[model samples]
Target: MADFNLSLFDTSPFFLTGIPGLESAHIWISIPFSMFYIISLLGNFTILFVVSKEQTLHKPMYMLLCMLALTDIGLPTSVVPKALCIFWFNLTSITVGGCLTQMFFLYIFSGMQSAILMAMAFDRYVAICNPLRYTTILTNARIAKLALVGLLRALLIVLPMPLLLSRHPFCANRIIPNTYCNHIGITKISCVDTTVNRMYALVAVLVFVGIDLTIIAGSYILIIRALFRISSKQTHQKALNTCTAHIFVMLMFYPPFVFSTLTYRFGQGIAPQIHIMLANFYFVAPPMLNPIIYGVKTKEIRDKVFKYSCRM
Candidate 1:
């Protein structure tokens, strides 16, 4: 009986499902997925390159933009290649170790992205609300420290996830109904009681995302008040323009993220394929759109892009 029970809890390889009911169209789907991946790579790399080359773009806001670009690059790169493999070659099997590694990177980058967005919100708040002391308050050293903090915070929060998962023995049904591994998805397949895992996941989301959103909301509220105090219409327009890109990027990121997270836990009536597609979109859309939005909205980046294109 003991050996039989052990066999049932064997840590076998997990087979990832591409799209729950859309397996027939995976090859066709890969085309758009490939396009988005390529665009994300080029767009984010361009942001990084433009920022590095332009001396004038060395302010705190641009520095934070660079961090955002890095996370954008990481967020999709963690999942897309493996997804492509599954779509193109029918290679859907992922080892336990491999799945955990993917989950770690995916969540770490996601956490880092949230942290960076929060930092960027602070940057905008300072730029708008405390323009005179902005340089002094957000010096290069301070920016570096903030970046380090973001990285460390994400690492600390996500490190235990895989460790927790590693201790749990998976059941015979090792099939994950998604293109990639995530904490909840992996936890759901365990035969053992996963109340602790679910609780931790909820706590992590609230602590990381909830706090960040609160800070961002507070920053924007102060920013709006500051703008209102500036009676000069032109000054208000200029200040508001500076924030449009970040606001658009936030819109690109948070809504889909919140929906996917909530739907996964609460939307049991939702189709599995719908959940899977939304999850994939949550990873893909922000990375692909962030750079494009920034490039179009920020004159400096747009100007640099044009200059480089002219040279090429």
Candidate 2:
């Protein structure tokens, strides 16, 4: 029994968690989560498909856009399958090794997505604010380098999470009370104390996602400042049009995330359910709404989607 690998994939015996106090909330939660998961899968995939099939979108901005679409697809793909099983099929059992593996991929997509978003913001900043050198600034080599940086940074930062998670020993009552296996919940099951894991989580967040988000914010500020300096109406209009999607996406992407961090870090024990719910939303909402928001707000992606759909 001690040598058993209790992973969901290994032994699909356990259900993730049943409803705590209110059974009705189970239906409410499961229904919406299922809807969100399906939509996100479809939306992100559609964007990727259209962007890939179209020849006109071969430029740097479109390349970055497609990369974002890919990340969004991968982020939820890592989460939703396990979540669906846990939520609906009653298959929640996961081994310590499996949980650590899941967390590694989870962190990879999260970190990679953050890095890609930062790169896209820089692309926009250069395209609109410095068109005189935009071609040279984001040349083919530079774009490839940015993509390499995102993957490498993600690889480097996320490796520690699984390594750290593996070192912890799980106890008998390993029924993690969440729809998916996240670090906070997984760490809670460890017989060994989880201070080190939490510290590692904080460090990874700081170095990868946190710093990238801060840099993204600063990039946008500079962009806005540049917007103010431009005297011509057309330039202002073009800048505003290009940036509006990014600004809204940033607003959607950042504020909930910040509050979510405080909630998960500080409120976990006191309000585990609420914190867990918020953490679930952190992945679901961003990946789900990103394509929709960007497509609706930007004409290019919207037109491309329409064109591809018509052809299909």
Candidate 3:
């Protein structure tokens, strides 16, 4: 039997399995996955382009939408291309440094998207709860500052992850049985003690997702209570209508995220393939669905999309 704790000093390439327990069907699976990649890229890029060129979109809400589009583009861009290569071309080997780089970008961008969502929630809260003062409250300067703060927060929170993992000696299995270099997935294969990494991972999740979710839920709760106080049905409907896209997009995001996180933290007995599938869904689904939800629900974006489509 091979020793599980044998530490090697040489830097060998880690083999990445595209999706465990379904390696034989990777070619077939890559079809929808390819479509997802195409749609995600095209959709998010179109959102960025449209929001940038249209002067009417230069508002706090759309500014946050642009932030979201960028993060959506980034979150999947960090993982999917390498996954596509693994699925289609059998390119599974990645160096330790390379894997660490991928892990860094993945965590940072994922955290960024969550932060952007919180910002969007705040935007809606201001718009609905304090309608007359919306513009005064969320000025361009404040929006810019919020965006910068979000990026900085994501950086500070996820920065420790790669550093912690890099110092650890990996003497166990070099084969990572998932599409991308996830923090948990990579750390599990390390030979040395990973308790610090695990603890910090929990801390990162709590600080980012846990705290953000609480704030977002609080904002919406206040918005809901304010809505109930208004006597006019037309005003209530109009206010709710404005939030439809954000609400739908949130639905597309958090459930899959919570499911994947739960599976990762607690579902050790779950099949590797299931874990990989949920992770892929968490990465791929939201980016592809976000623009679609906004385009369908928001009249301004929808009309602009149609106008641009006709011109081109």
Candidate 4:
């Protein structure tokens, strides 16, 4: 029970305690992160504000888009600010509670983003696969209900991640040297065993990322099948057009999602800096890209953006 001995855990596991090797490379990463943070905020905020201003965009699809923009806006904003401070400003000290708080929001936004995207996919599936029911199915009341449920669902999925981390005791010498405290990173600081926390981590990743991906794939499978059976080129073209933005978004979300999970599981200590950089990008890239991908590819949004630009 040496681990229980106070001196043995003066900090946490030697490897997991705090990042070692404070060095110069962090500065290089910080500049890009700072610039990207601004871009993500402006991009997501513009989508949210412009969509809100246009009465025409108050429909289900746009409502979901706005909700998505809000979620996207927060995801990176939660992680990158602290990361930048650590990299550039040298703010290395974080409280145990503060670390858990950061982790909670980070996971919250990530889960919410996936949930919203799955909702959007369901929206498209209805639009293309069952056009007649699209109106009745995605009414404003239902959309509102879905948003509330999405918030609650995200809360439920992410709840265990931070709660599990909080239960782990942080011995003194709390110097998490990275930009922000990640969920697993904070858990690593515990002086004791955490099989329960690790199981929760795996379960959270599977449920939110895993199940969301499965549903998205299923939605598209049905959509593609319906497209093939349709006879008219014009109708097919229109249906295909609606999918363009959604497909673009899925492409952006999954790469970072898969890579981050793998790197976290297998890449620790082997290449800590590269892994840290990937973790940073995982949180930052999706929010920044979502607005750009959806706005440019979506015709209605493009028009609304133009109208908003003109009004401004």
* Top candidate (lDDT): 1
**lDDT of all predictions, in order shown?**
0.88, 0.74, 0.86, 0.76
> What digit string (tens of lDDT, one per residue) describes model 1 on residues 19-58?
9899999998888888988998999999999889989989
Candidate 4 accuracy as lDDT: 0.76
lDDT of 4 by residue, 129-242 (tens): 889999998998898898888789889888767655555566554555455777666656566787888888888888888889999999999999999999999999989988
How well does candidate 4 match the true structure, expressed as C-alpha RMSD? 4.1
Q: After superposition, how far is residue 200 of candidate 2 from its true place, in Å?
A: 1.6
lDDT of 2 by residue, 1-312 (tens): 543333332332223574344334765777877788788889988887877887776778878777887877777777777876766666667655666677788778877777877887898889777899998789767887899988998898788776665655566777777666667777776677788889988887778757888888888888989989999999899788887777776776667766766676776465667666777766778778888987897787899888777987
Which should have the higher lDDT, number 2 or number 4? 4
Best by TM-score: 1
Q: Which pairs in model 3 have colliding backbones? A: none
- Candidates' RMSD to native: 2.9, 3.3, 3.6, 4.1
Error of 2 at 43 (Å): 1.6
Better of 2 and 3 by TM-score: 3
List TM-score per model, in order.
0.96, 0.89, 0.95, 0.89
What lDDT does model 2 reach?
0.74
- The alpha-carbon lDDT assigned to residue 36 of candidate 3 equals 86
